[model samples]
Target: MSDEDLRLSADRVLARLVGDPTDSARLREDQWRAIEALVAERRRALVVQRTGWGKSAVYFVATALLRERGSGPTVIVSPLLALMRNQVDAAARAGIRARTINSANTEEWDTIQAEVAAGEVDVLLVSPERLNNPDFRDQVLPQLAAATGLLVVDEAHCISDWGHDFRPDYRRLRTMLADLPQGVPVLATTATANARVTADVAEQLGTGEGTGRALVLRGPLDRESLRLGVLPLPDAAHRLAWLADHLDELPGSGIIYTLTVAAAEEVTAFLRQRGHTVASYTGKTENADRQQAEEDLLANRVKALVATSALGMGFDKPDLGFVVHLGSPSSPIAYYQQVGRAGRGVEHAEVLLLPGREDEAIWRYFASLAFPPEEQVRRTLDVLAASDRPVSLPALEPQVELRRSRLEIMLKVLDVDGAVRRVRGGWTATGQPWAYDAERYAWVARQRETEQQAMREYATTADCRMEFLRRQLDDEKAAPCGRCDNCAGVRFTTEVSAASLDAARGELGRPGVEVEPRRMWPTGLPAVGVDLKGRIPADEQAAPGRALGRLSDIGWGNRLRPLLAPQSPDAPVPDDVAGAVVTVLADWAKGPGGWASGAPDAPDRPVGVVTIASRTRPQLIGSLGERIATVGRLPLLGSVAYHDGEIDTRVPRTNSAQRLRALHGALTVPPPLAAALAEAGGPVLLVDDLADTGWTLAVASRLLRRSGAAGVFPLVLAVQG
Candidate 1:
């Protein structure tokens, strides 16, 4: 690792670039100087170049220099598939013997590996996720290690937790390169990196103190060809409407970003409905669909694309004339990356954001979901630690016992938190378990919060939007671009007041109405009879006399019976009896399982009953109760409850049985629903009567919690005791 040994005197590396006849692109003087310095210094170097500054050219130049001097093959590790593809394509266009390894070419990866090993491949582009493969590391990497070559890491900022787009897998690359010879140099390049990120990249690459060099090339972040605009939209719908109105004005190649898949679908649907051809991309999208959509956009078959942040990184659609964020992003880095997609071909472009009052709230939710609470971190770590080998999503789901949706969100959160690392096929723990600092987590959380706040300010402030962005990038002395929303003739207006924004509200609750018993009357009887006959509306049956008579005749306690009961004229129930009913309801609300709820002898048996309150034969409730009983039979069963009618059937019906039947028809279990619930880290039982309205017993346990059900084992059945 001496200075003399580190120097890139290898002329063959330089020849690899300049020797290629197709490499017509020339490096700028500053880029050349940086390249010369890296070659002479022979140490790990950080090259921070501006967008379109041809940072790739410097690497190519150095590669040419090394090739001329008979250096070994060069390997470039990239985080983006599209970026890797683009780099490989560029090298091929330059007549360099370059090959790439990514998810798209599994069958060819082994051949590519052999080629690299035999020294037939000069440059190799791969993703960090691919490095975890035992075959790649054990068989393929050793060959690359033996060759006299350089390792180039692209988008190196991903190594830093503080970096806008942090990737935990990037941290493992240091160990991956540990076996390389001491004299071999490593070069890292990025378009954007603050001092903190720079230091992090160097440290993660194991470029020890004074052994690494950083070059921060100054360039204008300002793009005069790009017109910045901000619109104050009340919601996503309005933003879509605005886009529709301006669709004709927008260029054919452009991108529209939404915060979520639902939003992306909605906007894409709205645009297509209005006669604009659009493609969409999101995590839920199938691989084929994603590729088709991307291809459609790239081929100009689709005039525009509505996507989430998934569209960034590797996408190289340089002809894009505009980039519009349906809402504000969680960070300035995200905003810059998204906006950078535009004007890449040196043509005029436009970037717009429809800022709303809830933008900050929306961004905060995304951030929080991305960086979950400490408990979640512990859970993820535990799950990873328990695994004997790397496991895919399907294999891990049952072990963690969480719903797929919930687990996926938590995984993404853990990824952003840097507590866990996801490789190509599986995940593993990263750093020390205690390495997750609360202060750093809080800072990132606050930074996300601040970016959202800044969006609000940008939308409402009289100053230029471009200037605000520049200041965010640490160019505080930069002047206004004089071409943004504020620079134009637009006037600032505050539609929402500070008080309204600051007002605290309850967290999002479950999405349905709760069903409570009509009267407060406790039944001393051990058995209750259920009537499956007529529609019993909550308001119509809220009478004390009717409820008491039914309770008195049903013999309510432990046994269940089904029978039709006519309305009876009875006196009002006593206050003491009513108070007893309240106590029972409270107990039901508290549910049957918890640390305070004493352990039962028969742990696998149902602990409580759920009676569905309906006038007709409580078939829906009966069927649901049976399912709950089955769930209670689970080894770890804690509680059980059933609803009498199809609580989920949103339709109103006068005939109870028909309504119940209809409800059953509507309650089909979603495929991913069971997986998601299992991942929630609990065992649950769902109950209902007749399984009618079909919704009550089908993933009802999970839905209840989602809808803000305060207690577990809440039941719905068609009987009264």
Candidate 2:
């Protein structure tokens, strides 16, 4: 075709994509170059462009062009569900039929597969994890690979370990790439990758034997519209108060990012209490609820969605007015990726960071869950090889000494490396020898440390914030953008009113969070000699309890952090904290989700108090129980003693099964306590300083039930969620 003809076809696609042929939506020259390389030359290409720079348009146009020329459907491998949804909707505007196959809509997978095979689907969006799903990988992936016209890896930086949000499932893309037919084009796109990640992903794009030279089109990693600033708050309460005061001042509906799910929920609740319309989006959020929250934010039905990183990378609202962070992310790359959500389609979007003292602590907590030692990986392989059967994740949890989340992460990495294979029932050893790369993981961890330091610098730097961030991403053209606080002077203020501050202090200082009892026993307990399985009997289970606060909550969490933090010396419950506990008790008696707030009927109030013996914080636990007993005028029943002193429950910090093993027969009800409980003939308030895994509480509750306590009402200073 002639150049004019090509330009006309492109413009027509762009118009369709934008849902307006006369909007004059034209592609940038770089975008056209990416499309031409993918469509005409059928070469591998990587596009490292800023957000809202028409990266999606390049792929959509390439798909249209490839389809017009009778190539098979484009398969887009994306990392997030929100992104998949956004892509589907965006594709529809361009008259491109897009179907997604993700975990949320498993029932529609068959239909989506049929549509793709029948040539009715223009763009097929699938999560990277789908590549490892037994049914999808075995039954559908092969056919999809053979028929795929163009393969697009969205957020392709995730394919590299150097990427801040690296996902192991993305590594499976290499197998798909190798399976594709000759001369098929492949495109990888990311806005967050530094030079190292880009080079690594580019190598993956070069994996196809018949694929020719790869084209790398990298643009300046700078957003002129974002005005970045950092407000260094003294504590979580002040940070939250600032938000409550200034949320109305932010231009449009946007996201409020928190570091943890609990933080997200807590912030959402606090914001709503402050009379702002908002919702929470985190990994724990139900898929349907998450979809609704995304819609609510997109439609401006809510002022903001208080969210964790779960809301990052795929929810699109071109006119997002602002982005705020409650805590600093561990790295500048990840931080930039999140703040990029703002000022995408609109000019002059406000981006603010309220960095807290707790930010580094949260960062350290995440750092601890990184890749495990080589021995643990070997142990996992040994167990899987010895099993001679596919061992599900739950079953594997008992045999492997790793925490569930970290273990699953390891298993996924192993699966991608061909060291293990996920099958019908679960995962099995692949009999492929794999050497653990200690140096790589160590390097990644070190990189994380460096990035964290950089984030600290980014927060306090006198230089331009955007320039600092761009430099962190290794942008060669990095220069002061003169738009951030350092360049333009403090743009967002930290000022908050006394009334607002008082409200925040009251909210944060007011202790007591609902401590949900564990309903079901973890599976595979029998393997660990615990003999427990299925649901815990209601008669033996601890009732829904109360805690002074969550360890992740911005309010009480800040106060509790120092007191309950690791290496902190244990002593009697401090006077102010004990007073807070008194406040918590007073509120718990009438609190919405607390013990006395039962819906069908008013729940039984504690008639007696019983302390759980603590090895680490005996004084704290003992004093807390005495205070509750003294304040409530209830009998202080003698404590539950450690019958088997051989085991330390928190030593390994293992999974549920192992935790149960540690707690099995570990507690003994004192004879006097047992007598007091029988005499009281009512619910007993069980006190402890911290509830980490709830197994200790579970074990204690079981003993209390066996010893004839009418009900076990477990209470704690902090509940780790």
Candidate 3:
């Protein structure tokens, strides 16, 4: 086709994409180059551009043109459910049919697949996770690879481990790429890949070694419409106060980004109490609720959605007025990506960061969950290899000490590395020799540390905040963005009122979070030599417990976290902490379903007190027990003892089954305490410093019940999630 003819053809597609007349919509030069590579040249391409830079337009346009030429349906590997929904809608505006097969719509997948087979679908969207499904991989993916006209990897940075949001499921795309028929052009798209991540993703996009000469289209990472600033808050209370005071002043309905689920919920509650209409969006939210929250945000029905990274990547709200971070993300690349969500479809949008003192601690906590050490990896492999049958995750947990989430992550990595295969029943060892990539993993960790430092620099730098973030992404053209606070001076007041501050302080200082009792024991305990399995007998279980605060909460948790952190010297419980515990008890006595609530099912007041002896925090736990017993005048039964004085330190075990083993016979009730339990014949306050895996309380509660207690009421200083 002649160049002018191609330009006119692209213009018509652009018009459809934007719902404008053909002459009013035209592709930029760089966008045209990307189109040429994908359509005319049939070449692989990686387009690294900023948000609102028409990356989607390029793909949708290409899809329309390709479908017109009688190509097979375009397969798009999208990351989030939100992203898939938005893309499907955009494809429709461009007059292209798009169907998605994701976890949210299991019932419609068969119909969607049939439509694709019948050539009724122009584009198909599938999440990275779906690529690993046994049925899809065995039946659908092979046929799709052979017939797919073009493969699009949305948020392709996920393919690189170096990327801030690397997903192992995305790495599974390698097998799909290798299976694609020759000349099936592939396109990788993202707005946040730094140089290392870009190179990594480009390398993976290749169908073969020499043939992988992808057309790389790089664009400047600058948001002309965003005005950036950072305010260093002294504490969480001050930060919450600042948001509560100034949230209504921001432009349009926006988002408040928090670092933890507890923080998200806390912020949402505080804002609502302050009369702001907001909702919480986190990984814990149900799909239906998440959809409603997204819709509310999109329609401006609410002021904002207080969300974690769960609301990120592809939530489409053009003219979103502002984005405020309650705490900064660990990496500048990630921060830049998140803030980019603002100012995309508006003339000007506000981007502010209220970094808290607890931010680094949260960062370190997350870093601790990164890829495990070589020994741990090898131990997992050994467990899988020892068994002849495929082992389900629940069944494998008893044999390995990793938590369910982390263990699942490790298995996915192993699956990608060809060390294991996820079959119909579960996972099986492939018997293929696998070598640990120590150097590579170490490099990724170090890179993370470096990125964390860069974010710190971005927060404190006197230079333009946008320029600092741009430099972190290795955008060589980065320059001073005059719209930021550093370049234009502070545009908003950081000062908050004494009343607001006091209100926030009161809310945060008020402590006590309900900790639901574990009903079912970790699955697969029998395989590891433990007798416990299935639903914990109701008779042997602990009643729902109460903790002063969650270890990740922005409130009292901050005060408790440092004292309980590793290597901290043991000390007596502080006076204020003791008072808070008393307050918690008083509230427990008077709160709903409490002993005073008069509900028939309410648990009876704990008649006697029992303390779980802590190996490291013995002084703290002992003081807590003594003070509570002294104040309430309840008899203090001699404490449960770790047999042989060998304490089962909660730090070493990462998962439930391991903790159960370490605690099984690790605690024995003193004969006097057992006798006291029989005499009291009512619930006892089980005092402990912390509850990590909850196995200690479960086992202890079981023992106390067998000794004749009516119920166990657990009260802990903190709940470590």
- Clashes (backbone N, CA, C under 3 Å), per candidate, total 80, 1, 0
Q: What TM-score would candidate 3 get against the native? A: 0.98
Tens-place lDDT digits, model 3, residues 167-245? 9999899999888888888999999999999988888887653445778899999999999998887888999999889
Task: Candidate 2: give its CA RMSD in angstroms.
Answer: 2.1
Q: Name model 3 segments beyond 4 Å from true.
A: none
Give candidate 2's whole-model lDDT: 0.87
Candidate 1 lDDT over residue span 265-317, tens digit each:
65676678667889888777876788788778778898788988887776777
Judged by whole-model lDDT over C-alpha atoms, candidate 3 comes out at 0.89
lDDT of 2 by residue, 1-721 (tens): 7666776798789999988858587889999999989887899999998888889999999999889999999999998899999889899998899999888898998888888878899999999889998888999999999999999999998998888999999998999999999999999999999999989999889986778667999999999899999998777778888999999999999999999998898788888999999999999999999999999988999999999999888878999999999999999999999999998888799999988877887888899889889888999899899987899999988777777988988999998888999999999998997988989999999999999999989988898899999998889999999888888888667778888788888877777887789888888888867788899999899998888888777777777888998799989899988998888788877766455676666667778999888778888888888888998999898788887544364545557766776667777887888888889888888898888778788888988988888788888999876
How well does candidate 2 score on lDDT at residue 101? 88
Model 1 lDDT, full chain set: 0.56
Candidate 1 wrong stretches, greater than 4 Å: 1-25, 146-148, 206-210, 370-436, 488-721
lDDT for residue 329 in candidate 3, whole number 0-100: 95
Candidate 3 collision pairs: none
Decreasing TM-score order of the candidates: 3, 2, 1
The number of the candidate with the highest TM-score is 3
Reference-based lDDT, residue 99, model 1: 85
